[model samples]
Target: MLPEEGVNAVRVVVGLLVRGEYEELETLTEARRLTAAEIAAAVARHGRDLISPPDAAFREVDAVAVPHEPADEHAFHVEFPLWTAQDGLSDLTLGLTVTEVMDGVWTVELDGVHTA
Candidate 1:
């Protein structure tokens, strides 16, 4: 099990993703090229249309805590169940890595994403 602080970090970052909090997301990412606003716009623009339907908004997200990831022992898996724009089922796992930037402050970064 992840420590309470680490779990909180993961939840906070994922919550930002769900809420489309671009400005805050910017600070959380390690991407050197794209800004958080750019990422947010992209997610909003293609979210449901490309992922769900012609114009279906990203209504909601359901996440499940999975076991520790084999690829990265330092990271953890959070599975998100979603339906495609074609109405087909697709699942995604967010491999998140949280680093202790300072005393009580932890920085969570998007390590990678697995889609199935």
Candidate 2:
């Protein structure tokens, strides 16, 4: 799997979570190639509503313009040219627990740990 593919998979997971489609998350996990970390990062970065307390946990990582490198047939890394958003994500230092991950699905548990 390519890095771009991984990024797309992250997007799917965010959509599923935002839409509250837990079943799609299950199906996406089987079809997409991504890591739980990537999905969690994506949700933290893109899923604005998912960004919870402490507020400083969210971060707009330099945009992922470059493709990701697949660790294997099932995993990949997020690469980028470092995008800067005008509104940039807030709380730029929170990490999430990967409760689940898949092509179009993802679930993360934010325990309020400050990555800063």
Estimate, for each residue in 4-60, the C-alpha lDDT of model 1 and write its tens digit: 566567666656665657577767666533467666555555454223212221122
lDDT of 2: 0.36
The lDDT of each candidate is 0.50, 0.36
Predicted candidate 2 versus true structure: per-residue lDDT over 3-87, tens digit per residue: 3444444455444554545455545554244344554455455434442222221132222222223422233232221111332
* Residue 3 CA displacement from its true place in model 2, Å: 1.8
**lDDT winner:** 1
Model 2 residue runs over 4 Å out of place are 30-74, 77-116
RMSD versus native structure for model 1: 7.9
- What is the alpha-carbon lDDT for the whole of candidate 1? 0.50
lDDT of 2 at 102: 51
* Candidate 1 ranges with C-alpha deviation above 4 Å: 30-34, 41-46, 49-90, 112-114
Q: Per-residue error at 52 for model 1, in Å?
A: 17
Clashes of each: 2, 14
